[model samples]
Target chain A: MWRDAALVAGKDLRVEGRAKVAVNQVAPYALVVLLLFGFAFDQDRPLLVQAAPGLFWMAVLFSGLLAVQRSFSIESADGAIDALRLSRLEPAGIFIGKVVAVAAQLVVLEALLAFGVVVLFQSRLGGAGLLVASTLVSTAGVAAAGVAYGALCVGLRARETLLPLLLSPVLAPVVLAATEAWRAALGLSRGDGWRWLGILACFAAIYLAGGAIGFGALIEET
Target chain B: MSSSSSLTRALGISALAAVAVNAWWGLSLSPPDKVQGQLVRILYVHPAVATMCYAGFGLCALGSICWLWPRTRSPRWDRLAVAGAEVGAVFCAATLITGSIWGKAAWGVWWTWDARLTLTAILFALSLGYLALRRAVDNPHSRALMSSAVALLMALTVVLDHYATAWFATLHQHTTLFKPSPSIHGWQLVTMCWSFVALGLVFAWMVVHRYRLEALEERYESEGYLVAIEARRAEGQPVSAAARPETGRVLVGSAASAERAEALVEDK
Candidate 1:
């Protein structure tokens, strides 16, 4: 299953590499969100620094929507979904693969957005290792959740509007936990970073298992 | 249908009696609290409606799980899920409204980011999303499948949010209603108990009516599908085997024609 997942992930990444939609459009859009947050706060440096963790994750969450949409839109064209159904690949593998591909895109988007915050908002990063670990784990949880819901609305008329509504609330735990973890990493508050990390890890595990188990039911055009 | 109508009628009478008794006992007979005074009146409505809200979503999740399991999967489960979610949404709205009113009287704000308040808001959004999802999909089976999966996910999120809320300290009081050693006594407790009975019956009545509404809509859609399929046959179009009505889904082409047929029928 891991091998099949890798193969599917590789295929999706290759397609993304060729299209560069995520890199060219979504990454820049994430930067714009950073700017929007700055202006929303009236460009107060202290306020921006204070809210950097949440703003960064919000940017990641918003960009993730596009990445997940693109991931499924590739298959929404032609008879691509039917082709996958006939491919004999494990449904769990496909789910993991999509999640992996989306996570990779989100990680890169997050990295760039983190940099943007450092420069634009002058927010200092204190615990680098904890920060990166939290980012990767939280990205996985968001990716799994996003892909699980993204595939659900594919090929529907209101999918574009419905996907965000379905996904955003489910991501509340991730946003809260990840922001707390980031706060701890940045030394903003005397919070237990490990506990927040544990929450993020549990979220990733639940979504990964859920997507793998439930993907088959979702993929079929019942 | 006759039995269900009679059952609803019985429920209506019981609900009325329960509401009347609770109102009289709670508003006039019950002594004012030493602390909150008249403000305590909101408790009778708020806590009971909030409990019913949670119960509605619990029922929705149970229905969704049953529908997901192959052995027990049925349209009735799907209908139950929809009914539960719709009624849950209504109760959820009521909870938010009454809670806000109480908050203003007690906390001096229309809203606060209290743990229970935030969780209830998220649940309200989730219920609305579930209903919106049902409206977006045209196919009954697909709608059922997708919404069932979503309902399960929403249920899990609710649990996680509950824990997360508890994990983080906030203004929302704990160990009140669900405590082993009860908090209040006398007419307050009695009225609260009576409110629960009234709200529970009202919830059951709403779910029954909503479920019947869904069944009628399903019947009308199926009839529309048959009409559309017959029209396609007359046009000599080759429909796929998958377009069979037995599958409980209308093909896209047939769905469009069905909309037209439904419109035409309405015109007649």
Candidate 2:
């Protein structure tokens, strides 16, 4: 399963590497969001620094939406989905592969967005260890959930519009947990970021298990 | 013509009678509350409807579980899940509106992010999403399977959301949890119990009707497909049997499907 997942993830990354959509389009979109946040706050450095954690995660989430949609949209074109089904790969492998691919894209996007926050919002990034751990775990959780829901709505007429409505509310916990963790990591307060990281781990576990088990039925319907 | 129809009819009549009686006692005979005065009257609709909404969602999750289990899988279970979700959506809406009404009287606001209220709102949104998902999928089996899966997820999320919100609210200390009943005695308690019975009966009745509506919709969609097929033949258009649309409802449109659908209705 891990081998197949790696193959699938490698294939996705190679395709993405060729197109560079995440770098050219999504990362810049995240920067644009940061700029907009700065404008919305009227360039008040203190307020922007204080709200940086939430604004950063919010940008990642919105950008993550585009990444997940693009990840599945690649499958829908040129009978790629049918090809994947006929490739004899396990549904679990396919699920894990998609999660890995989306998470990889999101991690890079987060790195860029982190830079944007530090430079644009003048926020201090103090806890490097906690920041990295929270980023990886929360990205996995978001990716697992995003791909699961992305698959759920794939091939439907309303896939584009319906994804947000269905995915966002379900992802409320992830946003809350990640934002709070980032808050603690940014030295905003003395609150424990580990607890929020633990919550993110739980979210990742639930969604990853659900995707692996439920992917067969979801793909079969397509 | 089954015995259950008579039972349903009896239940329906009794539920109506109970509602009428409860309304009279709850609004007229019951003394005003010491704190909120007559504003507590919204309590009758709020708690009963909210309780029924919870029961409806609980039924939906149970039906989904039954449908998903290979040993217990049946179209009947899928139908029950749909029926419960639709009814639950209605009651959930009522819960929000009545709760909002009560909140306005007590807190001078139309809405607040109290823990229970927030959870209720999320449940409402999840149910809407579930129903929307059902409508998006054209195939009957796929719709049933996918919606059941989503319903199960919603059920789990509701549990998680409940606890999360409770803890989050305690941490913030900005809002008090909305609990309607502190201490009730005498007629208020009796009337509240009667309201529960009446609303419970109403919920059962709505589920029965909604289940039949779903079955009828399946049959209708299948018949429409058959009509299109016949029209294509009449127009001398090439109609390949292998190329037929995979509606999965053709069987349900035929006599066996009708019998099975009726059986489910009667069995309920």
Candidate 3:
């Protein structure tokens, strides 16, 4: 299972690497979202700094949608989904691989957005340990759920619109917890960031297990 | 079928009577709350509607699980699943509306990030997604499987979401109605419990009707496909060409002819 997962992960990542869509498009779109937040907040320095954590995670959540869509869109093109099914890689492995690939892209996106938060919002970064832990767990939660849902909608004609509508509400808890954790890490809120990290971990575990167990059935029909 | 339809009619009548009595008892018969005064009346309707909302989703999850299990898989279970989800989504919307109104009256705000309110809103979205998925997938088997997967997912997320939101922020009052000692007594309690019975009957009636409608629709779809296939066969089309996999509509030669046939069928 681990070998299959790694192979699938490698294939997805290699596809993403060659395509450069995440880099050229999603990353800039995320940065632009941060800038737009600046505009929405009227460039209010204090408010922008205060809202940085939420704005940052919201950008990640949106970009994660694009990453998951791209991952499955690759499969749907040229009958690759049938090929993947026939390839005999375990469904759990495929699920984890998609999660890993999307999480990897999201990690990079988060790093870029973290920098944007600092530069654009003038937000100070403090708790490094909390920041890293929360990012890893929350990204896993978001990516696992996103990949599971992406596979569910892959065969639909209206997937482009349906994916976001279906996925965003499911990811609400992750966004809420991650934002709280980041706010604490950035010294913007007085809440315990570590406690929020624990919630993020719980969200990640439930989705990872749920996706792994259910992905096989989900994709069988799709 | 006659017995079940009779049962549904009986249920509908009982539900209407019970709701009427409960409304009168709650609005005018019961004394005003010492704390909330006249605004306390919202409790009778809001709590019952919210309970029905959860009950509907719980039924959906049960149907989904039964369908997912290989031993119990059936179109009946799928029908129940969709019926439960559709009815649940309606009650969920009502729950939000009633809860919002109560919140505005009591808390001076139309909405809040409280645990219960947020969770209901999320559940509402999940159900809408499930319905959208049902519409998007053309294959019946795929639709059942995919929507069942989504229903189970929503069940799992509801558990996680409950805890996540509870810890995030908890402004809603804890379970006051279902406590051991209970918070209210006498007429208010009677009225509230009666409201549950009333709304629960209504929920039952709606789900039974919806389930029946779904079963009939499935029959009609399969029968329509058969009729279309038979029509094509009479026209000397090959069986293989007449029976397309995704949609059963017969295709004659070019795309333009296909569209024309489709339009003719639509007109008829």
Number of the top-ranking candidate, with DockQ as the measure: 3
Query: What ranking of all candidate models by TM-score puts the best one first?
Result: 3, 1, 2
Ignoring the other chain, what TM-score does chain B have in each prediction? 0.82, 0.77, 0.84
Predicted candidate 3 versus true structure: per-residue lDDT over B24-114, tens digit per residue: 9998999999998998788889889877877788788999999989999999999999998999899889989998898899899999887
Q: Which regions of candidate 1 are displaced past 4 Å?
A: B1-4, B160-168, B229-268
Q: What is the Å distance of residue B192 in model 3 from its true position? A: 0.7
Candidate 1 clashes between residue pairs 3 or more apart in a chain or in different chains: none
- Per-prediction DockQ, in order? 0.64, 0.57, 0.79
Q: Model 3: C-alpha RMSD to truth?
A: 5.3
Candidate 2, residues A102-194, lDDT tens digits: the string is 999999899989988888888889888889999999999999999999988887778897888788877777887898898999888688999
Candidate 1 residue-wise lDDT, B1-268, digit = tens: 2326777889888888888887888889888888989987887898889778878888899999999889999999998999999998899999999989998888899999766688788888888889999999898889999999889866865674456446768775554556687788888878877788888888888888888888888887888778676767623433344554532254556555545555665677
State the lDDT at B223 in candidate 1. 83
Q: Which candidate would rank higher by TM-score, 2 or 3?
A: 3
Query: What iRMS does model 1 reach?
Result: 1.5
- State which candidate has the highest lDDT: 3
